[model samples]
Target: MRELTTDGLLDAVRAWVVIESPTNDAEGVNRVADHAGTLLRGIGASIERMPGRDGYGDILVGRVAGEVNGPGLLLLGHMDTVHQRGVFGYRVEGDRAYGPGIYDMKGGNAMAVAALQHLHATGRRPRLPISVMMIPDEEVGSPSSRAAIEAEALRHRAALVFEPSGEGGKFTVGRHGIARWHLRTEGRPAHAGAYHAEGRSAVREMAHHILALESLTDHPRNFYVNIGIINGGTHENMVPAECSAICYALVPTAAEEAELRAAIHALPQHDPDVRTAVTAGLGRPPFAKTPAIQALYNYAAMLAAEAGLPSAGERVAGGGSDGNFTGALGVPTLDGLGVIGGGPHTREEYIELACLVPRTRMLARLFETLGPGVAGL
Candidate 1:
C-alpha cells in the first residue's frame, strides 16, 4: 500500500492552518471551505457547497462513487477552530506545530484531504461509497451543522470523525454526552443597609443551586456536572435581584443522561423569598460505546497493529465532539482520528510533527480499505 509522505502531509497541514477559520468568522471559514472544495474537485469527486445556515458558514460535501455497489461510509471533519484571529495564530517549531485549530481539527481535515488525494492518485477503490462532509461549526457543538451530520450519518453505514486523537496518538472509541444549561434567579431588590429584611437576594439563591448542581458528579460512573460561568449583582450596596449562570453536565450513557436531566429539571429554588427559574436542555448526547463501535475499534486496532503501532485501546470520559451527534443515531462511529496533541482550547495547544505522517497514512488506509467498492456492510 502506498503511504503519504511526511513532507506532503505537512504541506497540506500548513496550507490549512494558514487559513484562519474560526467558528464565528463566517467569511474566513467560507474561504477555507472554498479551498477544500477545489482540492476535492481535483480528486474526481462531485462536490456540493451547501449555503451557511443563518450566515454562519458553508458546509462542503464531496462524494466518490465506487466501482461496485455497496453501503457508503461518511468521513466527517470541521473547518472551524476555537481560536480568534489574534488570540491564536499558526506557528511551527521543531517537531511540533502550534496553532488554534491545527491539532484540534484543521490537521484532521488536512489528513482527510490528503487521504482522498492519495486514493485518487493511486486509483484505489474501496468496497463501499465514500463521502466527505466538512462543516464549519463543530468547535461550538455543531449548532449549525448537527442536522447535516445526522442526515449524512443516516445515509451511510458508518462514520469516521476526525476530531484529533488523544494524547500519544490514541483514537477514541467513546465520548461523554454533554448538556448545557442557563439558570436565572429573580428576587426583590431593596437597600441592603436599610431594608435588608424586605429584600430577597437572587445571588444567594443561585449559590444554593450551584452547590446542588455540583453534587451531581458521580466519579465512579463518570457522571460529572460543572458550573463553569456565573454572574450576578449590580452593586455591592444594593440587594441583587437577578443572577445568571451557565453550567455543563457530562454523562456516559443514555440512562445516565436522562437521570441527570431529571435531576436538573427537578432542582428547586432554595430561597422562599426569591423567584427561581431554569432553562435547561441537552447540548449534545453522549456517544455511548456500543457493540458496533466496539467492532469498529477492533478493526482500527488491527489496522494500528499492522502499521507497527501500539494496540492498547482505551476509552476516555472527557470532552465532546461532532461524533456525539452521529453516535447518538446508532451509527458505528470512531473519533479522535486526527493528529496527536494536547492542550486544545488553551494557549499551549499544539500537534506533534512526528505523528502527522503515520496518522494520515492510517486514515488513508482506512478510507481506501472501506471505500465504495467493498461488499459486506
Candidate 2:
C-alpha cells in the first residue's frame, strides 16, 4: 500500500477557507475560482472560466486528460458558501480544523486536489479523463450553474459531488429534491392610530401563509417545508403594505415533489382584501439512490477498506447538492464525498484532521481506477 500525508493538503484547504465567498459576493467567489483554476492548471487541467450571471461568481471548469478518452468522471463542487465575509476565524485545534467554508466543502475540494497531485507526482493516471467543475451559486440554488453542470454531467458516465460529509464518516448517496418558493402580499396601508379599520395587513396574510406552508411538513413521508426568511413592513406606526416570505420544500420522491409544487403554488390568500403572489423558483432535483449507486458505494467502500480507512456509511440526505441534477438525469452520482464533519452554515464548522490522507487516498484510488475498461463507473 502507498502512504500519504496531509501537510500540503491542509494548506490548500486553508488557502480556500481564508477567502470569504458567499453566494451573493461575486468578487470573492471569482477570487476563489481564480485560485482553484491556477491550482488545477498546475496539474495540467484545461481551464475554462464562465462569467457569473444573476449576481454570482464565475464558474471554473478544469479538465485533466486520462489514459483513455471516453466518458470521463465529473467532479462537482461549489465555492459559494452561506457565510459572509469574516463570518468566523480559521484555525487548527486538536483534530478539528475550524473555518467558515472548510468543513462545508473547501476541505473536500482540497482533497480532490491532493488526490490529483498525488496521482500526478506518482506518474499515475486514471483510466478515464476527469473534469472538475467549480460552481459559484450552489448555496442559493445553482441558478446560474445548473445548466452548465447538467451539460457537463451528460458528458460523463459518473459524477462525484464534493459536499461536506456527515458525522462519523457518513456520505450522502441520495438527496431530497429542494424547491424554493417566494411569497409576496400587497395590501392597503393606513394610519395605525386613525385608519386602522381601513388598513389591510400584508403581514397578517404572510403569517397565515407561513402556517399553511409549515403544515405541509410530514416527517413520516420525508416532506419538509421551511420558511427561512421573511421581510415586511416599514414602521410600527403604519400598516405594512407589502410582505414577502422565502421558503423551501424538501421532497423525497418525484411524486411528492409534484404534489408539493402544486401545494406551494396554490396557497390560498387568507386576507381577501390583499393581493397575493407566489413565485416558485426551480430547485435541485432529487438524487435517489438506485441499484447502480449502491453498487458504486460498494466499490468505493471496498476501496476505503483497501486503503485502511473507516467503513463509512451512506445515507439519503435531506440537504441538496449539485448531484441532484445529475442523478435525476440517470447519470450515476455519488455525493458527500468531502471531508467528514458535522457543523455547516454555523460558526462551529470543522473537519476531522485525521481523515484527510486516508480519504484523499480513497478518492485518488477511485480516480486512478474507475473507468469504462477498468471499473463499471
Best by lDDT: 2
Per-residue lDDT for 1-377 in model 2, tens only? 12467676778789999988989999999999999998888888999999988888999999999998988999999998899997688999988899988977888888887788888888888768999999999888888988999999999989998897775777788989988878899999999989899999999999998998899899999998999999999999899999999888888888878887787778787778999898877687887888778878888888888877788888889888889999999998988889987688999988988888889999999998887744355
Error of 2 at 289 (Å): 0.6
Kindly report which residue stretches of model 1 are placed more than 4 angstroms away from their true locations once superposed. 1-3, 371-376
Which runs in model 2 stand beyond 4 Å of their true positions? 1-3, 373-375
Predicted structure 2: lDDT: 0.87
Q: Scored by CA lDDT, what does every candidate get?
A: 0.81, 0.87
Q: lDDT (0-100) at residue 226 of candidate 1?
A: 90
lDDT of 1 by residue, 1-377 (tens): 14577777788888898898889899999999998888888888899889998668999998987655656888899998888888867787888888878877888889888877887788776556788898888877888888989988999998988888875767788888888888899998989999988889999999988998889889998888899998998999889999999878888788877886787688886788787777864488877778777777777767767766666365764788888888889898888878778788886788888876667667666776754323224
The TM-score that candidate 1 achieves is 0.94
**Model 2: number of clashes?**
0
**TM-scores for the candidates:** 0.94, 0.93
Error of 2 at 331 (Å): 1.0
Residues forming the 10-long window of minimal summed lDDT in candidate 1: 368-377
Clash count, one per candidate: 12, 0
